[model samples]
Target: MTIALRDAREQLRDRFLFWATLALVVASTASLVTGAIALHSDAATYAAARDQLLALGKDAAAIAAPEFYPLKLMRGMIEQVEIMGAVIALVAGYRAAAAERGRQTLALILTRPLPHWAYRLAKIIGGMGLAAVSLGIVIIATAILLPVVSGIGLGTDDALRLALTWAAGVFYLTVLFTLGFGLSLWARSPASGLIAAFALWILVVLVAPQIGDTMDPDNQVAGGVFAQLSVPKAEQDRIKAGFAGYETFRNGIEVASVTKHFERFTFAILGIKDTYTGAPVDKVLAEKRGDLLFLFLFSLGLGGLVLLRPINPDRLTKES
Candidate 1:
């Protein structure tokens, strides 16, 4: 417990970790601000268009009120985190193992009275604790900002959704952290560990998603690729249907990319997906059960692997 606490405090004081976390918060907050402005602008435009139409004796029934789902505004923040926040996890993970080796502290720490398994467990818990704290900041900021931005207080459902997203974000970041920690454990130096970690990050978060998007044109862009194509819905649907075995291919890609799984689950929970909007929260969750489950297993399995790996100071030092 002491080791865990000490390690967490050390991580908290790390300048790189602190600044990375701050950047994450700033990016997410910016997304919230931008989303708020966009929402207000949209509302204003709809009102103006409606007034003009009504004054011209157009049918009032034709105008629809844009349903302001406050939590949906967090879409940008979630994506930003998936992209930029992964780097934070990589840094934390790399530091967890690499810093100890670089400073030659691992040899002394290993010489302590503590059992090897216990020491390793403590470090893993400490790393996860730091990740939770960083994600907690995101959740708190989102909670505080949501009500102010949308002019609507969080309802029971909205609060639940936010909670779920927070949970997902924690799990997502922890997975990356564990991956980084594992890479550091295997590498000879901090630089090698960081490089390996970022390489994995690029492959998982960037390459996989881009390949998936390329394979399925409809999923290529934000707000659906068809939205920007000026294509009719029927034509889009027809084009989407024209592809053979695309659904299976797309699902396979999404399953491979942790980012996709996290994004899909969070988007469903927050009603960011068009099909999920106005749907019952329970139904959306039910639909996304596979994604949520896969993400949990993937994270926990990798974390467990890290926990089980032997932390030999001699091997780490020799490699360095």
Candidate 2:
């Protein structure tokens, strides 16, 4: 507990955490504003078109009023998490390990009365605590700002979905944090850890998705390539089914990317899945079980790596 509190204070004093938290808040606020404007414009356009058709003596179905879903409004915020959130986690982890080494405290800590695992647990707790603080700010700010901007009240389901999205964000960031922590443990210097961490981030978060799309052109854009070909949905499905093996391979590559899992999990939880929107939370969870499991296992795997890291006092002394 003492070590955890000290580490937390150290992290709080670091400028990076403050800046990252500020950026998240700003990004979330921007997403809410952008979503509200888009929704209102869409509502207006639909209403105008409906009026035009009715004036032409054609029956038009009444358009439903746009409902403000806070989670939906946070789409951009979630993407920022995929990018900046990972960066924050990487930086935090690297700094934690690198700082100990640079300050020559690593050997002293290892020689302390406390077990080595306890020190690691303190670091983990401190790093994840900062992450939770940042994510909590994002969630709370979004929840408060969304309804104010959209003038729509959130129902119980919306609150639940927001909670679920928060969980996904925590899981996603935790995975990235541990990845960096493990790398920092292995790397000789903070620079090396940062480089390796960012490289993995780029590969998993950016390149993997692009590779998946390139491998299966149908995934290159939204609505599938068949939409551009003007094929019916049924035909598109049939054509895609014909390339089942290739599609499976492509999906495997993507699923292997933790970033992809995070995005998919967040989308499911927040009702960004078109077919699953307005569905019960249970349905979303059921459909996204694979993604959730992948994220959980990935996090545990990295954590295990950290826990199993060599704790030789001689090595620590030499490194320090």
Candidate 3:
């Protein structure tokens, strides 16, 4: 344990970690500040729009909902944070392992009295610890800074959501690191390992999501562009029955209300909508947690393989 702690401390003291941590802090602070400013500006615009709509005798309740504006602004800000966080994770993860290989220090480290697993474990824990601390700082800064700038305070639920999102960030970092570490072991040089890891990250993050969406059964193309575009009579009747008592919105205002007859019916029971665009907040949170867990397990599996591989760090010559 003492040795592991020493290793972690040494890792943290490296210049790479120092600069990476600084970069993360600056990036996160800037993003939060910009988001706060944008939200405040948006709030002003919304107020002006609301006044104009009111002068025209239009219902402004939907557009002027205080909760709606904050939610939209906050969600957008969170998404930006998520994107930056992922990039930080990927860079940190790849460098964590690749640096040792680049320096040809892996052989020396493996030759130490410390067991191979300890070194690998230390790398994983130390790398993740640094990322978590960096992310936490950003989260704490945002919590304090946002309310001051945007007049929007984060609640306990929001904090929990942010934490969960950060955990997911950690999982992604771990996956990238493990993949990079494995490639470092397999490749002759650090450059090749980094390239391979980054390419894989791009494929997983970008292509995988698109593949998932494409394979979704609900996402389908129907009839030609201009063939009266009507549902089958039976389907039309079913749809009408489902929407019999639902409110409909056009633009930002609710213009029509269906009868109250379906009030007792569950959304599922009535099949009113296949899925709501904005899901129940709790479900979304749970899904994020699940994604984090999946990534963590996958990374762990990869790391395990790296641990079990024979320690032949001297296989690559100086020329190679």
Candidate 4:
């Protein structure tokens, strides 16, 4: 255990690790500040819009509803936080193993009595530990700063939701780091490993979701389904015509109501809904955690295979 800790400490002491941690801290702080400001600005605009609607003879109940503007601000902040988390993870993962490979010290380090897997595991733990600390600090800072700037209180429920979101972010970062380490082992060169890892990250994190969305048939709907529902076409047309302008009014009402409802509920500290369209977010989080664990095992498995391969030091010296 001591040996492992020493190895991990040495890894973290490296210049690259120091710089990476610094970068994560700076970037996370900036992201939180920017997100808070933007959310506050949006909330102010929404309040003004709500007043205008009320002035136009909309009932106070309709204009002052909880779902009107607050939810939008919260949702936008969540998205920005996720993006910032991804950036921190990606940068940290690319540097984890690639830097050592670039220095050509990987082979020397592997030759030690300490197991190769131990070194890899220590790097993974240390890198992720650092990232986790940064994430926690950002969350804490955001919680305090947002209320001050936006006048939106952060309740226990908000903290819980943010915690779950951060957990997901950490899982994603761990997977990327392990995969990057594996690529480093394969390439035996830091630059090549970094490039390949980032390319994979982009494919998995960005492109895959888009492709998945496009491939989902549910995203597309045809007019034929409604037409074939056995209702009289004339009756359907009459209903549609009667409600021609209803969509706009209904949307406005929904927006106002939801906003107001959430605002009151936020004060009550009601937890966020953990499921989206029948899919439990907790289940998704578990799956992601499992995936990250598998990736770490795979990286270790490959690293062990690399270690088992016989290396002829004499042949290398002769060639040199």
Candidate of highest TM-score: 2
> Positional deviation of 312 in candidate 1, in angstroms?
3.4
Sequence-dependent TM-score of model 1: 0.84
Candidate structures ordered by TM-score, highest first: 2, 1, 3, 4
Kindly list the per-residue Cα lDDT of model 2 for residues 175-284, writing each as its tens digit.
Answer: 77777776776666656777898899899888997788678786677876777779987887898788899889988888878888888888878877677677778988
What is the per-residue lDDT of model 3 for residues 1-320, given as tens digits with 9 covering 90 to 100? 65447646766677865676566556655656776787777677888889988999998885845542222333333434344545555566556666666566776777778787777777777666766676667656656777777766666655665565556555555655566656655667656766886676566554544454454323445432122455576775676566544412221121110101111111211122234223554665343344344555666777788777765675643323
Best by lDDT: 1
Model 3: residues with Cα > 4 Å off, grouped in runs: 2-4, 14-18, 21-35, 41-65, 68-91, 98-105, 210-289, 316-320
Off by over 4 Å in 1: 41-66, 220-246, 318-320
lDDT of 2: 0.78
> Per-residue lDDT of 85-144 in model 4, one digit per residue for the tens?
455555565565555554556557767886655666666666556556655665565556
Q: How many clashes would you count in candidate 4?
A: 8
TM-score for each of the candidates: 0.84, 0.86, 0.63, 0.55
Model 4, residue 166: distance off in Å is 1.8
lDDT-based ranking:
1, 2, 3, 4
Residue 302 of model 1 has an lDDT of 89
RMSD of 1: 4.3
Compute the lDDT for candidate 1.
0.81
Stronger candidate by lDDT (1 vs 3): 1
Weakest 10 consecutive residues, lDDT, candidate 2?
A: 311-320
Clashing pairs in 1: none
